[model samples]
Target chain A: MTDAIELPIAANSDVVLVRQRVRTSAQQVGLSLVDQTKVVTAASELARNTLVYAGGGRVRIEVVGNGARGGLRLTFADEGPGIPDLELALTDGWTTGGGLGLGLSGSRRLVDEFDLDSEPGKGTRVTVVKWAR
Target chain B: MERVPILKLGDVLIVSIQIDLQDQGVLALQEDLADAVVESGARGVIIDISAVEIVDSFIGRMLATIASISRVLDAETIVVGMRPAVAITLVELGLSLGGVRTALNLEKGVALLEDRDNARAVAVPR
Candidate 1:
């Protein structure tokens, strides 16, 4: 694991910034154009979720290496009204917030690994990683 | 907030997105395009996204919404120049862009609009 860069997700512009930073880090980890696009797209979804669902949050982006290969990892955490049902939240086309509801489920398909943790009154944290192939 | 420019060409309105758009910019473009379609009385609207690197659900939905809005306004919307990688990502992202029409490039997009116009003219006399 290398040094991580953390950015605040307070508004819509922050989501764009997170995407840009994730794309840069993905490239630095030697991910291909397609992989970079995938991760960056995933970052955009999660970043927006943090801002819109959680009101505000922060993200930590880092480059990771496993043996000989490299990967990019992102952790998005928000302290707002957390999800009560993880399964429902991950369901396709399920949304309480007027969005298309693909933010969580769709992003999960884009990356290599995904983990979501949330409590109704606590917070939500989503961690995703995409390894270079 | 930066706004995407809309150019007029005869009966078509063209918008080429060259910047990494924020969500607000995306919404603004939608409103602007709808207004332009009504005000200019354009028959077709073409969006060029060759310069855009990624298309998340928000942008994907924006395209669909624009198409729906233009259809109601009696204008056709064609999205052109989607990168292959973005295409792959979009499919995996579960956004089929069902109601949106797409072409490989701007020229083909214009040709498609013209073809549709010709077809309509043939189908209806006037």
Candidate 2:
């Protein structure tokens, strides 16, 4: 399973398209419906966050797995104003926009693995993984 | 997406979900909504999602959360208008709504609730 999906997040709609691609790709590689849905959901959330919070962004979902613990790794990057305090933003009930502030933090709950990186004036990138047995 | 609120069939409140259905607001709304629906004295609820283009694990979980609250409040919960594409995406992605009820569309979902209320109304004749 060596497929990488990359897309620019200029509009909110693109998030849906890219997430669909991830779902298809994961299923193509023997990922179960449940596993595929879990990852796609997380990926879609990241994509939307990039579009809304980051102004615009892109994504790359790579398959990284071994045996029973196989999983998908999603890399979401955006060029918008990065989060000044990643720790505070990760806190529940804390949001800049009207949302529940669960885009970054909530998405983390769906997958089995999570990692995020960002810098003010630079950009933000989030990575997530969902396991399949 | 347009929201079409179904009125007066019974104690059931059906709110058409016709937006992005993304992010956290949906999550918090689920909480407030369950309480609101229960507080509104509704016997059941149906959320239309035909216009929704995308769904994630969080949405699935949130839907389940809504169902849980509804059950605790003694109200029925139903999800309507699930697109085939979205369903397939969720299936392949391994995302599931857990225990929430689903319908082909809002009309069917509302019918279920209305049917229940209609039955109850018939049983309690004035």
Candidate 3:
């Protein structure tokens, strides 16, 4: 069975909410403290990206189990201007905003699975997953 | 708006962040801390983040900026009481927080500041 929670990502406060929910879900899946932190931090980065780049969107967090392993999966979907170059965007130190440019690449490094899809003038969707050891 | 309280302890400034910070809130804190450093002539600033569980890139940059501001103002800044989880996340996020000194807790942070002060005093001629 897959259980998911949907959180709105319109405002800055929603970023914090996403992090908290992600942490709770990570803990519930028996993720180690370090693993928990990594997933939550990734969620925070993606949630912020959704708010800033996508002009606000929604995130779906789900808990999944595979045999003896359990994991958490997060999906961030936005309807704002999508990225034109997914390759350059994934490069470190590349940012369209006045940020440290660690939102995309850094978050990708923190999780076990990552996927990105964006179409210019359309929107962007990012999915990441981290499994418990 | 929630504001992080900056307390003056002798020639040091103590800021304890007890709540998760919003974008505006972090900006306000940056302003307030800069003003406090100038107004109080504090020689050191100790920030306690034990109560804060998360520090994204925004908040991470805020800490680095605060440390930079304090350095320019002739004050030392030390971040203390970071949760282990936060530390792990910060490293994975690739924010090394360069130029910022950190301590395990407030007490050690104060001691580190004092050590610096004493070393300076001993090195300088009267």
Candidate 4:
């Protein structure tokens, strides 16, 4: 990774900052307009999840490379009450927050790689990557 | 909390979102639009999001909610000027904006509203 930045996700405004920072990193990594939009949108969803579900958290935006290919990676971590069921949480239309429940599932579809980890009493961490095409 | 401004044009209320709207701003806009639709007695509401770069689940939901709210107030809602990339990202994000109508740009959106009004006028004979 050449450049990595961390931003807080404590409030609604912070989520907007996360999205802007991710979009900049995605563009710097040579992502196309559509690819930039995809990664940024995914980042927005995860950042909001950190705030709404976990109370507050932080996100690390990184520019990664694999030989000649470059990608943008985002890691959102929060210490709030962790999810009990990973499968159920990732399922579409299943939400406890009265939302559409598409944040996790839809974000997964927008990126090339997605990994989520959470411990009931511990915390939750979600990492996603989108490569430039 | 920065609020998105709503402009009035003829019998339509136009809201051009040019900022990276926070969640609070989105909610405020929804309320503002509902009020504007009623206060102005607008027959149509046009939301221009051409300047908006991304539309996450929250923003997508805001659009749908605004559409529903305007419908309840007896005004048609049409979202216009959505960037191609934004459209693609929204679909991939699993938000089709189901109840919200869309147009290529503001001009087309206005024309659509006008056509609907004309059709309604003929049908009602008033």
Number of the top DockQ candidate: 1
Candidate 3 lDDT over B31-50, as tens digits, reads: 99999999999999999999
Candidate 2 local accuracy as lDDT?
Answer: 0.73
Ranking by lDDT: 1, 3, 4, 2
Question: Going through the candidates in order, what is the number of backbone clashes in each?
Answer: 0, 14, 0, 0
Ordered from best to worst TM-score, the candidate numbers read: 1, 4, 3, 2
lDDT of 3 at B84: 93
Which lDDT tens digits does candidate 2 get at residues A1-133? 5567687888755876777778776776567665665577777778878887888888887777675555677889987899899999887557887655666766676678888889998999898877776
| Higher-ranked by lDDT: 1 or 3 | 1
As a whole number from 0 to 100, the lDDT of residue B28 in candidate 2 is 56
Looking at candidate 4, what TM-score does chain B attain? 0.97
Q: What overall lDDT, based on C-alpha atoms, would model 4 receive against the true structure?
A: 0.92
lDDT, residue B95, model 1: 96
Worst 10 residues of 4 chain B by lDDT: B117-126
C-alpha RMSD of each candidate structure in angstroms: 0.7, 7.3, 1.1, 0.9
Please give, for residues A1-133, the per-residue lDDT of candidate 4 as tens digits.
Answer: 5688889899888988888888888889999999999999999899989999999999998899988799988999999899999999999888989899999999999999999999997999999999987
lDDT of 4 at B7: 92
i-RMS, every candidate? 0.5, 6.5, 1.2, 0.6
What DockQ do you compute for every candidate structure? Answer: 0.94, 0.16, 0.76, 0.91
Instruction: Give the per-residue Cα lDDT of candidate 3 at A1.
Output: 49
